[model samples]
Target: MRILGLVFAGTSTPDRSQMADFLGDTLGLPRVEVGGVEADLFELPDGSTFAVASPGGMGAPRSVGFLVDDLDAAAADLREAGVEVGPIGENERERYLHFRAPDRELYELTERKAGIA
Candidate 1:
C-alpha cells in the first residue's frame, strides 16, 4: 500500500467550543461545516484538514490520516500483515479506516472521492 500524502490530523478535547474558537479565531484557519459530525473542521492551505472536537468524537484522542490511492488494497495489505484495523468509514467526500500501530497509536488511511482534490 502506497501512501500519497498527509490528508488530515485531528485532536479531541473536553472543551470543544473553546478549542474551535482558538483554531478559527486565533489561528485563522478557514472553518467549515461537516454534516453529521460534531466538530470544527479547518482546511489548511494545502487542502489537508484539521479537526478539533470533543473527546470521543473521532474514537481517538488524537489521530492522523494519510492519503492513499487505494483504500481497499491498503486495508487488505495491513490486515494481512496482522495490523489491527478498524472498520471502513465513509462520508460525503472520502472513505477511510483507522488502524492501531505497533505503538498502539491510532492512525487513518483515507481515499478522497473522485473529482475531489
Candidate 2:
C-alpha cells in the first residue's frame, strides 16, 4: 500500500497549546483542529501534510515526522535554537533525527538521499 501523509505529535491539551504557539509563532504553520483534536496542521509547499495532535490520552498517535532537505544543517539549526536533537539514523533512502519538544512529544526530521528521484 502507498502512504499519502501522516499525523504525528500527540500531547495533552495544555501542552498542545504551547506547541501550537511554537508551530504557529515559531514555525509559521497554520493551526487547525480536526475531530476534536487541536493540531498544527502543517502543509508544505510541495503539498505534503503533517499534523500535530492534542489527545486526552485517547488516540493512538505516532511521533511527528518532518522532511528536511539537509539533515545535518537542520540538526545544527535546531541545536542552535536549544532544541534537543538525538543521533541520526540512516537508511538507503534517507536519514532521520529525533527530538523532543518542551511538551515531551517526539518529532523526527528526515533528509532524503541525494538523487532519490
Candidate 3:
C-alpha cells in the first residue's frame, strides 16, 4: 500500500489565501486552490501533495488516503480478507472508499485521476 497524501479536515472557516501563503512561506510548499471552498492542493517539496479542506468539504479529520492502482480490486481484496469496507464515493475526479481499521482509525482507498502522479 502507498500513501499518496494526507487530508486535514476541520470545521473552522478556511482561508485558502492565508493557507497558501503560510504553506509557501513556512513549509516552502506550493499551493493551488482547485475549488471555491477551502480545499487547496499543496505540492510538498518532495513532490507529493497534501490536501487541506474544510470539514464539510473534503473529508473528516485524521482520514488516511491510500493510493491504489485499482479501486475495485483493492476493495475486493479488503472484503475477501474479512475487512469491513464502506461504499465508494465519487470525489473531485476520483473514486474512493472509506473503512475503519481494528484500532478504529479511518482509512480510505482511492483511484486517483489520471496524470496525478
Candidate 4:
C-alpha cells in the first residue's frame, strides 16, 4: 500500500512540559489528544498534519511517522519481503507499528482503529 503522507515527528523526551511550551507557546501549534496519546496536532494550509508526541527518552532526535491505508497488511507485506517489522500496537481508537529502515532511520505507521469513526 502507498503511504498517505508524513504524519508526525515524534520525539522521546523525559518531560514534555517545556517541549509543550516550545511547541505551543512558541511555535503556536495547538495541542490535542488522539487515541490516548497527548500530542500537538495541527493541519497545514496544504491539508497535511504536523504532530509531536512525548516519549520516555531524553533529548533524542525525532522520528518520522506516516499515515498508511492498512497497518496489518502493510506489516505483512514488509515481513514477507524480509524487512524487520514491529508488532502492531492497538488501542481503542488507533493501531500503529514502528520499524527501522535499511539506513536505520526510525519510522512509525498508523491507521484508525477498526470500528472507529
Q: Rate the local accuracy (lDDT) of all candidates.
A: 0.91, 0.61, 0.64, 0.68
Question: 1-117 in candidate 2: lDDT tens per residue?
Answer: 122243233444546667767777898766544333245565545544445556743233456666676778889888998998899876564576788879887777766668752
| Top-TM-score structure, candidate number | 1
Give the lDDT ranking, best first: 1, 4, 3, 2
Stretch of 10 with least lDDT, candidate 3: 4-13
lDDT of 1 by residue, 2-115 (tens): 999998999999988898888899999999776655678999999899998788988899999999999999999999999988999887788999999998998999999899
Per-candidate count of clashing residue pairs (backbone under 3 Å): 0, 0, 0, 0
Q: Clashes in candidate 3: how many? A: 0
Name every residue pair that clashes in candidate 3.
Answer: none
Q: Give the TM-score of candidate 1.
A: 0.95
Indicate the worst ten consecutive residues by lDDT in candidate 1.
31-40
> TM-score per candidate, in order?
0.95, 0.48, 0.65, 0.74
TM-score ranking from best candidate downward = 1, 4, 3, 2
RMSD of each: 1.0, 11.1, 4.0, 3.4
- Per-residue error (Å), model 3, residue 29: 1.1
Worst 10 residues of 4 by lDDT: 52-61
Which whole-number lDDT from 0 to 100 does residue 67 have in model 4?
77
Higher-TM-score candidate among 1 and 4?
1
Which regions of candidate 2 deviate over 4 angstroms?
Answer: 1-61
Error of 1 at 107 (Å): 0.4
Judged by lDDT against the true structure, how good is candidate 2?
A: 0.61
